[model samples]
Target: MVTAARLGPEERARAWQDLGARELDVLVVGGGVTGAGVALDAATRGLRVAMVEQRDLASGTSSRSSKLFHGGLRYLEQMNFVLVREALKERELMLTRLAPHLVKPVKFLYPLKHRIWERPYVTAGLTLYDRMGGARSVPGHRQLTRTMARRIVPALKKDALTGALLYYDAQADDARHTMMVARTAASYGAAVLTSAKVEELLRAGERVVGARVTDVETGESHEVSARVVINCTGVWTDDVQEMAGGRGRFRVRASKGVHIVVPRDRINAEAGMILRTEKSVLFVIPWGTHWIIGTTDTDWDLDKAHPAASREDIDYILDHVNEVLSTPLTHDDIEGVYAGLRPLLAGESEASSQLSREHAVARPQPGLISIAGGKYTTYRVMAADAVDAAKEDLGPGVVDSVTENVPLVGAEGYQALANQVERLAREHGVPAWRVQHLLDRYGSLLTEVLHVAEGDSSLLQPVPGAEEYLRAELVYAVSHEGALHLDDLLARRTRISIESPDRGIVAARDTAELVAPVLGWDADRISDEVAAYEARVAAERESQSEGDDLTANAERLAAPDIRARAVGRALD
Candidate 1:
């Protein structure tokens, strides 16, 4: 059996040592889906690979997406068949083969305001969407009358829709999926390290060779050499290009997208809804116990690391979503809000919504490759194309990408384990629902998580403040998953940060205490972590209240990064 690639503190130290001791075939910078995907692709192709991220995996745009894997029905209307077909094929692959444990089918209802011509138009596009990639994993489009549509979605206003068309797409927890990709790469012998920032690019004369990486935790620096350096920094693509001492062949524009989460009861819907906005489409996705809405597309020039959602952005979404809801949502109904920046390829269009979702790869100079602008669904393709671009420096022995055949860490035996959910629950002395939840999130790897609870049934109990999670899961996050801080566990490893109404403030102290022993956090460090998490939540709340981007950005920046604070104390 292949050993599960556990990324605890010990493994991270080994990775940093490996990076400094040996020359690598590929060094992938940026730990988002694309960068993680690149590391997996290069590793599976029999190349020595290492990946570095300044923050946790999927901490940026990867975690804050609308979380859909679709053919972009709007693109079909634009007559972009190639992009739609490619995305749909990738979607099918994910649902059926690649990560069935993480990605699953989701249905969306498109409410039509017009009586006659609208239904046919949407139906045609959906029909094309259904057949584009030979989509067979999920059911095709279905037309519904106003009564039938209302039966499915009770929240819709009586006259809000003349009729409706329902279509199938897939959704996944983006951060979890990205972390699994990184873990899978590590399992395949790739040195994956987080909180390791690349301060500068290493060059041998005109050819880029490697990078100088800094360990954010200890403030230690190391020079790591690689034959090929692939840059997958999404919004910071141009900045990395500048670090290479040359003008990039293409420019990357930052587009801000914001999503608000509300309790599931706030919107009485059996199926998710898709509404047409003047600039772009809006999705009311059905998340577990909550409904995710909004995603305003606007230009963002301030902070790429932590994009702030203004009050205007919130109002824009609420007003549009209220157009069809019988019971309208108010500001008080909102549980959480998050903002992310999409690295869109620059074009002539003034509106960010008009920019292309297609990705571009450039060999800006020898041994340097940069990829940008693709959406979440097509990250694997983008990664493969990036490696293809780096083939010149990788030499002739490098094999073609086999990531399509590679399942992520927990995907294997998932179906069998899912079938025995009841038996598993009985063994663990927990509810079947809890077992099912663990199965969905960790798949066959649930055994490893449950192992942390051995000799103590208390670990099986639900976590305080966030009862949806098990206490064992928190310990496993530090002992197995690469979680170094409270924010890493709350935000990306699990999703308590964005899911909780208090924005994980209520869970901070308890969660910090839970992982303190494993992460070697003393009393002072635990207090500091809890304090920092509280300040972050407060800053986010303050930012959300601001009316404009400038004020919001200023407010959000008030919270200092934990790593920066550590560096500061070291300097003192």
Candidate 2:
């Protein structure tokens, strides 16, 4: 078994020192899936690599995705077969080979509104989708009459549709998946550090040499030297290009997508559902004991760090999904809400939905390669292309990408552990469901995680107010995962922010104190972290109550960023 690299405080400090001490082959900026993918690809190819992120891993757009790894069905209609086929191949890889423990098959029911023509049209699209997937890990489409559909989803309105079609896709915790990717890269001897922001570009004569990075936690700066710097900052691609003082080849436009989480019992559906909106498609995803109904796609020009969901966005989702629901939901039904930005390649179309999801890689300068505009499912392909673009600066004898054959950390013995869930649950004195949950999250690393709570059984108990997670997980988040602040623990590490009805406010203090010893937080530090988290939740709540984007953004900006506070600076 390839043991995962520890990303705790000590490892982070060592990584920072190593980053500044040597001249690396490739320096990756960004800790999202694509950046992590590039680090993994470059490292496994026998190149010295280091990656740095300004915030927690997957803290931005990567964490807030629809959490699906499917070949885009809409792309088939748009005749973007190359993207669809590539994404499908990647999805198959994740399901069967690379990350089988994290990615799982999920079924979605497409309700047909047009009686005579819809079925055949959808059938044609789904047929090509099934064929493009190559090695099939999920079942193909199945047609069902209105009555049959109602039997599967009793929550549907009587007149919602005449028939329905079911197709298979895959889902995962995007944040956890991205974090695992970063850890896997670290395990492959790549230096990975979070809370390290790129302050300036280091230039040697005409060619870019490296970056001046600032440690956000301690306000200390270090210069990291490398032959080539790969920019994979997604929505912040333009910002990085500007920082490099290069002539950017392309522009990235931000598109905001919002999702609301509701209790599962509110919608009595065994299978997830997909509905066609006027602008884009909406997904009613089954997320644990909740149903995640989303997404309104619109152009966003405001804050990139925090995208706030306006009242109109939430109502738009509710109005569209409620069109077919037997029991129409009110605002009170929403347990949590989140918004994220998509970095689309700027095109002629005025609408964000019309922009291409296809990625682009360009060597705008001698030693700087910038990659932008890609879906999460195709991140590996994007990463490989970025590294390939940097080959000129990387010099000779560089090897090809080997990540397709390399399984992520914890994927090796996941199935073996999965087969022994009952035994593990009994030994741990937890329920079978708890073992299953841990298996899905940590896979074979569940043992390593459980090892954190060895001396005290109380740590094994569920987190106060957030019963879905154990107290041990919070401790593990700080002691194992590189969670630096309370916000990281509540938002990215455990997803308590968007999963809890109170937006994790009730559990913030308890969780902060839970990891205080590991994080070396004093009483004032714990108080500050808890207060910041609470203010963030309050700002989000107020933002959701606003009528438009501008008002929502203003409300969201009221909360001070904890990371910014650590650096003794304010967000621009």
Candidate 3:
């Protein structure tokens, strides 16, 4: 029986010490889906692994994705059968075997405008999609006429569609999923540390050996030795490769993708909708009590850390989505907005959307390996391939990846516990819906979270401002989920930053105070955390109102990072 891999403050200190004390078989950079997957893959394969992230896990593109786990329907249209099949297989694995708690099946309606030819054409595609990788986890597509389609989505314009095709795909909280992957890696004896930035690559002659990492929280630096370093830094791949004194074999181009959140009532839809745009597809995905509609594929050369969604980007999404909706949505209806950069493999096409979603792995140097360009659905395959590239350095004894068979930390017995939701609710003295909510987020590991509320039943009450989350959840994040900062808790752990209308402002001070004791935060530190979070929210709000990427990026960067500020003050 595998126990829950707790990633509390104690574990973080031990991880830092362990990374410096031993020579690791593999060192993974980046804490996105691919990076975390690589860490789990390497650790489960019986290889010693350590992963370091510059900030909280999934602080980059991983958290800001469209949050789908489907085999790209557009990929099938592009005749990229191999990529689609591989992705569908991974989707099946996630929904059925790997992360049943995190990944759940979601229904989507594809509106058909052309009455005569479109239905048959789409039917053929959906048939292939259902059969691809033996996708039996989700049901096959159902055709619906305009009358029926409008019933399912009353917000649809009468002329918007003649009919629709309903199909199934999987979705997950990308940030939570990535963090769980990191914790699962730690459970398997992998040293995973966040807020540890790689300042430089340690070199021995021509071969890359290790890295000098600086703790972002403290100014302390450590030289961690590893036999092979796998670079999964996503968009920052080129920058990291340059530090190794090599230009690298491939180039990565950043494609900006932005998503806006609106209340579910504004959409008036029973199911999510997927609309075809001239450039690409637009997904109005269901996200809790809100709808997430987005994604513009445009080249971006600005700041990678905080990719801002400008007014034009927001207008583009609203204009396109409004074309199909009966009741047009305005900027006032938007509750939250976020922007992320996709690391596409650069090609001669000049169009970021045309660039390949297929990933590539290369040993740029004897000891350095880099993997990039894959979509979120196929992160597991990317991880496996990345580790395969590092095989020569890992020696003959390292076995093949067993990650396909290995469920993540909270995955085990999830179904059984889910069946017992009513009973669990009775035991916890919370509403059945609340118990189900906890079960979905934490799976069988819900027991561990409830343990935090053992003596104090008030901990099970809803958070002050973010009522969707229990106070116990916030405590659990700081104590066992490696949330080192206020941003980590609100932004990644619970997503209150993006879900709330005020962007977690009302909850910042209360949340900081809740975890103050666990994190050893003094009064000054607690105040700083709340102030920094407020500044971040303000900057993000200001950026969204800006006209262009340049202005938005500048505004977004105005917020001082609390960790950076603390380090500077300490030195002063």
Candidate 4:
């Protein structure tokens, strides 16, 4: 059996010591999905690998997403056939081989506006969509009349569509999925550490060697050596390149996208809905107990880390979706609002929408590889190519990439375990629905979460403010998922920060306590962390209630980042 991996203080020390003792074959500079995938790909290929992130895993764009894994239907309009097929193939890989624990199939309805000439045109496209790389891991697409479409989506106005086409695509909790990818890499002998910032590149006469890494938690800096360094920082790709003192092949620009989550009752949709908008595609995705409606695409010049969504943006979505709805959803119906930036390849065109989603990997120098421009679905292929680029640096007889056949940690017996969920739930004394939820989220590794609840029934109770899930999840986030702060737990680990009306405020104290034992934080520390999370929630709330962008941004900026505070204190 493969040894279970954990990144403790002792292991962290060993990781650094190995850097000086021997040069690492591959060093990844991001903790997002792409970086995690790179680490796993390199490690599986029998090469020494290490990954460092400046913040918590997936703290940036990776965490905030529309959370769908689809063959880019809009790409068909542009005739970007190759990109769509490539992404579909990778999506199939994720649903089947790579991260079955994290990714699953979701069905969406495409409503048609035209009465004539639309069905055949849309049907042909969907038929091609079903055949083109998507059929490998998902069910076939179905054609439905307007009545049938309305039956599944009652909130949609009857006259809004002439007919519909339903198709399946993959969806995931993006943040958890990214962390699992990182953890899976660690399980396969890759050294993964979060909150380790790369201050500068360690270079020897113009060739990249390694990095100077700082432990944000301890304020300790260490010199580490590597043979090949791959920059996997998404929106911050340019920053990493500058640190390595190399000119990148391409520049990255930030495009802000926003999503709003409301209770499922508000939408009354049996399946998700996808519609064409004047600017971009609008989706009402079906999340568990909630509906996720999103996404406005506009260039962002403000904060890249936490892109604030203006009240105007909210009204934009509300107005558009309300136009197609029988009963409109007002501000009161919104439970959560989040905005994330897409790391798009920059272009001279005025529209960010015209920019390409295709990722590019280039080795500007002999020992440095920088990968940018790819979408989430193609991360594994990107990682594989990245490792392949370091073949010379890893020395003679470097093994070929074997990640295509390697299953992610929770994937081995997932289907079988899913079939036995009812029996497992009966044995565990929990409801079948709860068991299904666990199996879906954890796959075959649901036992890891259940172990905590078995000893103490109290841990099984739903959290106070959220009440959507278990308290054991909070404990697991710290013990296994690398949750560093209260915000990490509430925002990314469980998404209670965005799912609830109060944004996990009432549950903050309990979540802090749950992580205290695992993190070894003192009482004062826990209180401070909880307070900080509450302030963040408050800031976001205030931001949404404002009338315009300027006031909203000011309100959102009022919240303090825990790492920024530590940085400020260190400077003082």
**Residue lDDT tens for model 4, 468-557:** 778988887777677778888889888898899888888999888887877778898888898888888888888877877678778988
Pairs with steric clashes in candidate 2: none
TM-score of 3: 0.99
Off by over 4 Å in 3: none
RMSD of 3: 1.0
Whole-model Cα lDDT of every candidate shown, in order? 0.91, 0.92, 0.92, 0.84
Which consecutive 10 residues in model 4 have the weakest lDDT in total? 1-10
lDDT of 2 by residue, 1-572 (tens): 56799999999988888888999999999999999999999999889999999998999999999999989888898899999999999999999889998999999999999999999999899989999983398998898999999999999998999999999999999999999999999899999899999998888776889999999988888999999999999899999998877658999999999999999999999999999999889999999989899988999999999999999999999999999999998999999999999999998488899899999999888889999998999999999999999999998898898889888888999999999999999999999999899999998899988898899999899998899999999888887888999989988889888888999999999998889998888898899899999999999999999999999999999997899899663221
Determine which window of 10 residues in candidate 3 has minimal summed lDDT.
563-572
How far residue 502's Cα lies from its native spot in candidate 4, in Å, is 1.0
lDDT value for candidate 4?
Answer: 0.84
Task: Kindly list the per-residue Cα lDDT of model 3 for residues 1-572, writing each as its tens digit.
Answer: 47777888888888887778889889999999999999999999988999999988999999999999989999888899999999999999999899999999999999999979999999999999998853497779999999999999999999999999999998999999999998899888888899889999999998989999988777788998999999999999999999999789999999999999998999999999999999999999999899999889999999898888899899999999999999999988998898999999998478888889999999989899999999999999999999999998877887898999989988999999989988989988999999988988998899999999999988999998899999999999999999989999999999898888999999999999999999999899899899999999999999999999899999999997776775675576
Candidate 2 runs further than 4 Å off: 569-572
Check candidate 4 and list the clashing pairs.
358-373, 359-373, 359-374
For candidate 1, write residues 163-227 as lDDT tens digits: 89888899999999999999999899999999999999999998999999999888888999999
Candidate 3 residue 515 C-alpha distance from true site, Å: 0.3
